[model samples]
Target: MSIHLENFKNNLKLRLDDNPQLHGFQTFKKTLERDYFSEVSIRICFKEAAKTENLVIEMDCNLDLLEMLYHLQKGTWGGNLSEEEDLPPNSSFARALDQLQELNEISIDVEEFSLFLNDCSIIVKKIYSNSIKDQLGSILSTIAEHYVYFTKGLSETPFEIYVPVFEDTIPENDYTLSKIREADNQTKDYFGFWGLYFDSEDDAVIYDLSNKSIVSGDLYLLNH
Candidate 1:
């Protein structure tokens, strides 16, 4: 009596429908469109693996768009941070950027991401716990709750589908670009840009922003 793919979809739909507030999202089909230097739409979709049978959540976001948007919103495009005029603390854009910065400070684990979505294709076989529905519901709720803010964050590098990775994981370098192209080939598995290797069961991990490599530890620098 294991969970099936259909069970995951049904349960997820039920979870979203149960919450009346999320009706505006239209079951995650709607994309977030914005124009800073150019028009960009944050599109989300669901796909299941044909062979490995993994649930694949796909998001279309570009790092350049996010960086430009941040600069335009914050007025930090050509000048240093100190020279830039800051927005009010309560501004939605400012607040969203703050949250995004916080997310970047601590690397998020693939097993634990605080974001939501409307539709998801989850491979039942990959889920290790019995509370699969509950897990999906929580994740979706988080996504829907901060949909706009999360969209802003997604416009950044590494382009988090759920979990956040390093900026170097982007296709700027040959190594990373090759990896990205290869990932397109393996559509069945979750292709995390930066693989996590925990040295212990500690809550903290050292994140090096310079080289974009993570070292598990408690006291780590927020920036290089």
Candidate 2:
């Protein structure tokens, strides 16, 4: 369970190099999800704060890794071998995870780990100005965090790294969302917001300022 940091760093460089579009970007946040053994995701954000804008990368897992680790510790991890039994009715989302296949050992210099990045490169083409380009190093240096470690046994906590993103302006009241709720509300707190603008009006991402989470309108209705 120990993470091979040197090896991972080297491989990550190769992975970045292979993807030409992700160059010139430093880490924003990286995490080893509980489902890290099955699926990995990379989120790229092109954020603009005043005249300063930079591409940020945030990595996370789709499922609760802490709960999975708890199950693993109890030796009751592989009860869901039958994929059909694990799936919720009419849902094809979990079809790609083969928990049994992921349990096998991988030899260094011989085999690769079962975990693979499934989030096809999320491309965010943002052009940063010269002033922003000059601020990249200092910005990254101020909040550079890297969480790459391995464990022989289960880690009590999930691995996470966070690099800060700066914004130049205060939240404005130009959009209806700004009037919806403030970040310090007792019921909901959303310190920031990001509007995923598409051609269609149906798509929306709402932030619960207090909770510091985003819930899409479509998924919110489905879950409720």
Best by TM-score: 1
Residue range 105-214, candidate 2, lDDT tens digits: 32101011121123211111111222222222222122111111111122322232111111222246434333443222221111233222222223333332333343
* Per-prediction backbone clash count: 3, 9
Q: Across residues 1-224, which tens digit of lDDT does each residue of candidate 1 receive?
A: 11222332343331111221222223222221221121222222123431211112222333343343445345443123343445321132223223333444322111111122122211211223212212332332233333344333333222223221222233344453333232222212122322222223223222232234443322211110
Q: Would you give me the overall lDDT of model 1?
A: 0.27
lDDT of each: 0.27, 0.24
Model 1 alpha-carbon drift over 4 Å, by segment: 1-22, 27-31, 35-59, 65-69, 72-224
- Steric clash pairs (candidate 1): 115-143, 116-143, 205-217
Clash pairs detected, candidate 2 = 1-151, 2-150, 2-151, 3-150, 34-65, 189-209, 189-210, 190-209, 190-210
TM-score of each: 0.21, 0.20
Q: What TM-score should be assigned to candidate 1? A: 0.21
